[model samples]
Target: MKNTPLNLCTTRLHGGEYGLYVALRERADNVMNAETEPIYGHKPARYLLQEIAAGNKEYSELLLSKETVIGRRETGEILHELALLQTHLWKAGRVLRVRFLEGPEHVHRQIETIAKTWETHANITFDFIAQGQAEVRISFTRSGSWSLVGTDALTERDQNKATMNFDLSDETTSPDAFPATILHEFGHCLGCVHEHQSPAAAIQWNKPLIYSRLFQAYGWDRQKVDTNFFEQAEKALITNSGYDPLSIMHYSFPPEFTVPPTPTPHNTQLSAQDIAFISRCYPFPASSTASTLLKG
Candidate 1:
């Protein structure tokens, strides 16, 4: 894949390289299914026993990722950019601080209003702060909407600069751009990678169509298209063998974008699988999600 520095799917990492940033997939990949055993991110037995004994099983699940990957996520980078998806995850139950560097109050309000939908299902929270160094500093620049996924948002060279963006000047460019784009970008902030990149998405893309369409629509070159759409994320991000085409994180592909012309509509809201992914990644007390190794 081409090493595109900045474009759509702006998952920033070290060395100015853009990549996917999926948090829980690295640690709590099993949270998607209650019946299946966890594949990764198991907490220590002593901590599990303590949490269970204290009746705080829910919070313990939230601690799974951080506690599990203390030294695990630092492996060698792979050719398909798998390591790019594996890092910068926040520990579960983190209150992600958000601040708008510049935008209308109503836009900010709408952004916050829509963001709560994700919070209801996940353990993560968004604290929209007026001042201070925020994890997500959003700007309404014309440079197109993008975000530094996961904890990478905190890695900006200039702390005062925006780590996320909302280019709302051309809302008519896509359906449900107001809230859908917001949800899509915030999904990145939560360490959720693009659904199209999921291993389950065995989409036979119309290559020529994708290249031309993206070039005409978003001004993205072939390399950027390959980096964002053609590339697939690791199987660790999959909750099940089935791909979720209705996922809010999946881009709205026109009919011609696919080989068989299967079109993905503009999804303004999160899918059931999207909820499950987020919930598993951010275990809440109400969800009662268990760690992979521990039976609590």
Candidate 2:
């Protein structure tokens, strides 16, 4: 291989063939071996995603663009050789200022009560205020729920613009729906990536079904789904405990979206592993030699 832009995966898997991203996504989740599987010639889950993302021009451009991977970084354009996963973490024991641009007082209070749960587990605090520049500026007017990963929120040049968005229309705010969605997005604020994107996860995604399902639900195309659910994290970037299917950060796909051995129900609370992972990442000081975990 010529080490072209397409061969960006550090491991250098197969040629970046065009349009195999779907099939590659399906096979990659099931196979795990030192040698590529002889069974139907399927490649390991990790190897396939890196190339498949690069294999198709559309997928490659969507994923590789600076805007896609941790946009608004202070310095360089290059994220990772392959930007499969991204996280920008804060130093332990830092206070993250949060400002809710607009929302009912009750709703804002509800968010604070739930989001503050992370503080019990990790060495961080959320300082919600009405004025002054905040690291995480939230708004409920947007159509979907999302947040910039950790410090990336700081890069938003416009102070009036929100770095985090939520859809809190009356129709969407069920008792269960609000908390689950907020917790997941706040996890991103704390520098966590989607749990499904973990390299160790190996979720056997029903690609066609997932595409159709998400398209109907959120109007996302295949590129968006692939970017969120297909590529596995590079082992080097993450400090993961073996894949935790129950993490609040993981998506709860319905049975139709995956093959057998279905995923856990929609997670509204952090799993034991989620608490442990955050604790590990931001361990309490032990005689002044406290350490930190680096993950995305």
Candidate 3:
């Protein structure tokens, strides 16, 4: 998730004040179960229809209904992210032009897959320009301490306009797995902070000492832990009750990050709640316009 398009889990800030950080999670078993609805992202047909009735347009005329999409569940969650991204584009009154740049290796192809998946869900058009130059470059600590992962981003005034470079060379990840991370980081790029880290997150933290223990086990220093873990916790402290621990933004440590209670896996895949939140947060203009037309 880090290289082609960054995911939000893998990288971390090294010894600098405002340097780049990437975060990728510990890779889970990549074998996806077709029967299991991915932890989130499935929209019930009735609900989707109800929302459409509320004023949203069905951009996906050629695509299956929400129910059919879930019943088959043939594709991965990348499609869901694309749909959500499209919703945001509609709301923001903007069009995101996605281009896949060819890199020296297969890395660029992976990035292309991530972008293309989004294009499909959002029902947007894009261009794939394969220039030989790497689409992205990896940034790291001078000490060779860390490589960019999905969870991290370099903090710079110029970072706003700069396209991030993600490092995908690490052997610990699977193809589909990285896409979720990429989606999360892209969420960050779009200005989303961690849901778990919100003020509402504290109510959901459930375990405190466990998190303490986790920090100890990983030898994760206080500063790194603050940025990666506590910052979100602090955010949770102030936010409202929509906090979902099963959120892809959450980490796997049990109650508190202590005794590894019940390994509540951090869903790398988007959840239904996440999809709804994205739809509301970022509805595409056409979708919004259609929604308004329906209301009127």
Candidate 4:
């Protein structure tokens, strides 16, 4: 499809503290797949509601749209693509400066681990020395509740800073992938968008049935589901062309998540495309440009 202007849409997922974005289809001929059962076991619908109410206004707006609700899986992937697109569009060179708030060990260590991976894959240096300032904070409020907050660069009298809040006591038992989630959210803190939503998000969606199940369970309409889950990532792609379904931002919905229980190769970590996207977004530039790059 030829380059087009941004299509106006809204999100349907209920958000409370998590970031949410809607995915819109770039083309009209794409049809929905109907070969899977509608099961609500993949992702909890309540999580989507909580994300709709997240602190970030932009995030909340994107998740509450009707179209967004339709593209259940696409919502998460598109956000990552948008975050990556922002980095490329803004062109931040590669140097990244990060500040970690002195907080709990579980979340702090998880952030640190993810920070290291980001530093390696993003090909940039990150500074975590905040002295006493809390740029990124991770704490728990209650069961089944977590938060990730971030702010772009600022030039006011007060020094610019970004922060994130995570409920360590939540359902994040597997801390290995926890770093990837933190990195994904941190990408937002640095003004990054989802990699899949970048104009390059053209994955064939090998498992449409799985996606359909997610949509049905969430009670999302067709338009919202399509935009939030499939097409939005290809809307404003920053790269030439290509889709990465294995992106860390991509949801873990595979064919196996459907019915029949067949052997399907599934990945649980970030893909090579994700690493490349991160590298391109966070180019290794200078410290001064780090903040500048974070601006847009």
Task: Give the number of the best model, judged by TM-score.
Answer: 1
lDDT of 3 by residue, 96-197 (tens): 333332234465565556645443333333344433322123332122112222212322223222234444453223565566555555444433456656
Q: For candidate 4, lDDT tens digit of each residue in 66-90?
A: 5544345645444433333322222
Which residues of candidate 2, in runs, are more than 4 Å off? 1-87, 170-172, 236-239, 261-263, 287-296
Model 2: per-residue Cα lDDT over 178-284, one tens digit each: 77777878887877777777878777888987687767756767776776778775563355688887788777656656787464566778999999988886677
TM-score of each: 0.70, 0.67, 0.48, 0.45
- The per-prediction tally of clashing pairs is 0, 1, 57, 56
- Give the Cα-based TM-score of candidate 2 against the true structure: 0.67
TM-score attained by model 4: 0.45
- Cand. 1 Cα-lDDT: 0.64
Ranking by lDDT: 1, 2, 4, 3
What lDDT score belongs to each candidate, Candidate 1 first? 0.64, 0.61, 0.39, 0.41
The top-ranked prediction according to lDDT is 1
User: How many clashing residue pairs are found in candidate 3?
Assistant: 57
lDDT for position 166 in model 1: 81
